[model samples]
Target: METKNNKVFLETIHRKLGFCSTTYVDPVGLSGGLALWWKIEVDIDIETSSKNIVHTIISDKSNSSVWAASFIYGSPNREGRDQVWDDLMGIGRTEILPWLCIGNFNEILSSEDKMGGNNPNPARFTSFHGMLSVCGLFDLGFKGPKFTWRNNRRDGDLIMERIDMAFANAKWRELHNQAMVFVDAAIGSDHNPLILNTSFPMQKVGKPFRFESFWTTKESCKSIIEEAWAVEYEGTKMVKVCKKLRGCKEKLKKKLELGFNPDYLVTEKIIKGKLEDLWQKDAMFWHQRSRIKWLQMGDKNSRFFHLSTIQRRQRNQIVKLKDDSDLWKTEANDIAVVYFVGNLVTWRTLAIIGIIPCMVQVVGVFFIPELVKIGKEKDLEATLQRLRGKDADVSQEAAEIRDYFEIVQQLPKARFLDMFQRKYAHSLTVALMVKSSFYKFVTFEVPKTLSFLNCHEHNLNQNKDLTAILVFSGIQLYVATAVGCRVRVTDSHANTLLPLDIKGSAGSLITFCNWASAWVVSYGYIFILDWNPAGTFFILAGICASTVVFVAKLVPETKGRTLEEIQASLTLFT
Candidate 1:
């Protein structure tokens, strides 16, 4: 029915039922921009039943708000659908106690719900099921209304589908004795309106209880009077009273726990068990199907089998990882898997280039000095002839040889050898040292013969005890240590003193370098110089120059001290 103003219609419903009213508009587009919709929502508190509050909404094409209210645009393919549902459920769970979720979902629950025989996408159906489970919603049984919508085409083919549905939450299920759906007669429209009847009795105003004068005193309390009354009865009355009190206490405790410990109490075990049971049931069905040829012919039942199989596998995985003993272990395993895959990809890329430079660099760094010394003494056949031809400028030749030796010394032997080995021996050694020192700082160990002072301190803190030593031994720590060693080496080469005196900040710097390398590795080609030999030499020279500067300026001095003491002594040197 049309009213003078659209607001008046909601007001009239509120006056008839005596309940609070509110309206919600769903935004247009998946990204959540405001849009026009024709939707009206009404909440009625019927004096008939404490829990029987009617929430109804009606909308049409004139107001696009109805479409938004029903989350028409919030499809799986569209963005922010999950967030919208989460927010909607949060509000519905809090404000509405006994919820009756009825609207045009704009999506079908299953292929059976649609008129056409066209196959439905499994992924979309899975997403719909997930939404239903997340909200803890169940379909209210409707026998009369088979279809709510029909095809608008002029063709002889008449296709009808049930796009509209009614869902109820746990609260509604508790108070509702019975529910049934009635399909109203269609009046030229392509859709049918559904009428729901719930069996709930009307409630009357309750009278306030009056207390006697003696009840005001603390000693003459309600519990004492109830106990006296129970004592007057037989053994059955005492047992019933005790049972009633116990039930009330248990219920109160549960209510308090639900309010205060919601996060910890929301266990998914029941859901997981249900999923597992589905798998076992399906397995039995498959065995039965294998034995009977008629069952094999009817393959439609296999749909449930497939769905349950997938859900069972997923739930099993979640349960395994969520177990108390397996949480951190599973996380560590996942981290290791990622690390292994990344390392494999990196090594594969290097192998494709067929460059043996790392190997050559390793041989040169470790064995070149010995080889050069031996070659000088054993291969001296051309020395006399070269001396005769050039008047034997001994001093100049010696100077040139000395310069070559110095350049060789600055070739970053340990760093180059590590790259060649691909085992990161030197980096791993430093990391172990750092980890050991960190452990020592955090752990308290008693010596075989404790001093008097140590014994006193131990006695003072007797109540508290420490267990489960923190060990950062994994890919995360390994990567951090490698980056730290590289940064230290780079600084040493450039002769620059890094700001290592700041406590705990060195780790932060190393972490930044590790993160930065991920982005830098992608743009390696941008830093490539000319391919000519002279250009290569120039690039090498530049590296040497930078190394010298870093060594002089940034590298911190760590000649004869442990890592733990290094931070404390940093300021003394500077």
Candidate 2:
């Protein structure tokens, strides 16, 4: 079953795994090795091989369709990884088939790609991004733990990253739109194995049989039930009742042949027509209830109609009402329904609370000066000087804002899609990275629900300490914002495309990411924490810590810099 020889070892594994063929590229100095085992039904043609990668053409025996795949084990050395990128670029140019590249590339596309460690070299990220762009490939997002590889360290020096991944081109995505990748648990190895399912798994569903109310209308139904009830059964009272009901259901089903109906169309039409009539009658009745009879009589302006309204009002008016238990009562009790029951506050009180705050804003708007961007030239200069301190010179900054608005007025209005243009790709990438990281960090820190708070309270063994968690989170967020402001301060339009629409779109993205992070973390807390709380918390803490490194390594500093200077710095990355 086992052998020291490489071929014999691989053959034994292939045989046990029910694979008909096996091949391997031997390891060099315990670093580089490659192996593949496949079933006899699959047809794979080896196109090229190297120490770093093996390229092959895979043919689906069932469909007679072919696709190319590159199995990579990239070199750890910098120069060697760069060579692998070059080789991929070359293959991307010549190969016309839909291609997929999957394995450990020994490189990361961004700081977000790794957890626990110093930020990776920016050059490596640039190279990886360039390679993917040249090849028109994108990550096929996975469903499992965020990271696929982790160091087997139990101490503070532990690290984990998604070094192993899968990428496919648009053609491959189109051909296999339903395909998905799953990360299996890593049993003895550091990296988890991936399972690529080309189609969704089949689910076996058992439908329970129920007795229908309509089945009673059949003439034979009563006889079927009577016969079932008359049969003798051996069980307790509850079990006997269940058996009788089940027997009656089965007899009725067999007698009626419920699976098929010859008169389905005729019966359906009659029922639908009756239902439509009922709906119309119900709608009309409600519509009549909403009408005001007094207003309708007044609108007619007729003596007879007006007299009838007055007579009805006089008859309905109460002179004295009898209380419950037939006692006479003079004082009227307020029995109106409370429409706004939130916190037991009525609608009138809620309206007053809302309107009272708006009075201050309505009055304060007149005293506030006009904005520099849209106000008259004189007002713009005065507002700018007041904001910048009267002693300071504000002519240039004022002119810049005014001139920018002037140019904006002359240009055609931008659409939402303008934010996604090629020229704005760098800005979009930065925006998404910052927003997602910010939300993920915040979502993890805050308790998503009461259960989450209870979990923390249970762990801390003090209900009062819950306040400390929230207080520290608030202080941390404030300090982080202050630090971020110190590092980057620029005009809004300098780093954004379609600035008017960015707020709405960014808000939507933030909300979606927040919800997604909450959902993921909830599952992680439920499933992962039950098994290993330390491991779960460690992964979350690593993610939170990595966000700080991501911002430091990726975001450009704009402190005390002009708009032109900021753009010049960002030019290097784009």
Candidate 3:
């Protein structure tokens, strides 16, 4: 439109785009021009025009609201910019309705809005900033590039500035709060086009599920699949296989949760202490999220992981670039996991590498059998390599594992009758009591007290009595933590249910015990709410004593005996 000598040539271009009406500010002999076009039935009336501005009044046609839009084309000359500023201010004074003033203003509001440009005159910024402040207009932040105008220059003397801008009054901004301006690609001109958007579609958070093929490494997978598929079912062969797959999924999930027992982790050795135990759970979660289902996983998982990330980056329009300086670095790409098999410890490391003396701060390190030394010189030369030397403790344990398992394999089979005997029964009873009470204290009182403080703040006594509430909460926390710490199972006490075992029986037992405790506490809360606190305590005390007596009469002992002997004795005695 800049070089089109007259409206005749411009009309041809305008007609091609299907514009019905156009309000034109003809170019000053190809030096400058402005064009504002509207689709048919737009309900916009052109109120005013100038060499650098096009003002219009717009109604929604729905009898909803009316607004004013002033399209600005600011002058590029250093001195002529002041004229543009005066024109905007004059128009701003007359805007009574919600106003949106936008277009290529040929100015920027801040220094950061320019790249590779001569330092902006501070007075120019003050002029624009002062205008906005005085008129109560806000710069509507854009969605695309920070700088709307690019130099597009390969020469050493290249520059870019955010000359184009959009500002709205408070009412206009509030009406379209998520409004955005996007920069379109340059077509036949140096300046890229600007697209204003009033509504954006919402994005979904999480993705769909897809199984991973990496879970086959765990031995539990084989047994779980076998057990699931072995069952007889009346169905089509495909349907039968799918039913078996569903069953296998459930079994594997339960197996994966084996080591996530919160109390067991805090009390007994955690999975992190045994990677063989932790590996299955990690595989389960990663497999569920990775969404790759190939038979032979190999390096395909990693490859697909990076490829999807790259595609996503493109979709999101994320720019990964540098401005000819290694001092400024981006350390977001690449991943390398170095594992030390001999010991149970984790170290997270992120080291950036690039040409021409780049630098990134590496965080955390682990001994890879031996030490992993990372050295960097003044010129940013560095080496990160794994070296090897086995620890004596690790070697000793590795040697003893076979002997330890062999002894365990020799032990006699365990049964339920073994749990019910004349001795050691009180220990199991106490375990249940302490576990129940700990959950009750933390789950019931802590939340209840906090709720009371928040929901009934005005009803409470203030100032002179505030210290009493604080002290009470503090004491409650201290006692709970103290008792909770003590409630962790002693190794001797854990052996009580050894015959019942961890895999086949413990999950159901623990779930039952927890649910039973919850029900008991729920029942107590009812009486405590309507009756005396004394009545509730008395009922709880009776339950505890009744439990002790029940254990004494029905349960058994396994103290100071090997598991095989204990199982044998209990089996014969019962």
- Candidate achieving the largest TM-score: 3
**Runs with alpha carbons beyond 4 Å of true place in candidate 3:** 1-5, 204-574
Q: Which parts of model 2 are misplaced by more than 4 Å?
A: 1-5, 201-574
lDDT of 3 by residue, 1-574 (tens): 2332466777877776567788787778767677777765467888888777788987765445688888888777756777777777887887788889888888888888888858887887788787777666877655556676766787867888887778888767656544566665566767767777654443333643334454565455677779887987779999888888888777766776673345654643544566544454454544444455563433333433433333233245322222121111222331111122113332111111111111111111111211211212211111121111332234343334334334434665434354345442443444344434434633454444443343344322233256457646644654565454444433343345434322112222333454455555544454353354334444444543454454455344555767676445443223
lDDT of each: 0.41, 0.60, 0.54
Measured against the true structure, the TM-scores of the candidates, in listed sequence, are: 0.25, 0.36, 0.36
User: Per-residue error at 488 for model 3, in Å?
Assistant: 70
**Worst 10-residue stretch by lDDT in candidate 1?**
440-449
Ranking by TM-score: 3, 2, 1
Weakest 10 consecutive residues, lDDT, candidate 2? 331-340
Residue 166, candidate 3: alpha-carbon lDDT: 81
- Quote the positional error of residue 301 for candidate 1 in Å: 26
Candidate 1: regions farther than 4 A off: 1-84, 89-96, 156-158, 200-574
lDDT, ranked from best to worst:
2, 3, 1
* lDDT (tens digit, per residue) of candidate 2 on 1-574: 0111355556665675556766677666545667877776678888998777889999988767789999887777889998999999999999899899988887776778788877777877688889889998888766556687888787777888887788888777656655667676787778887777665432234646755544444456677889989987888999999998888877876866653354753575578665654444333333333333444411323323333333333233332333222223333341122212433863344444544433433322222222533467787677566756879998887677666556655666555466566655555555555544344433544333233444555534354466566646754664575456435522343344223334334334433553444444433444454465445545555554565666666566656776556556555334
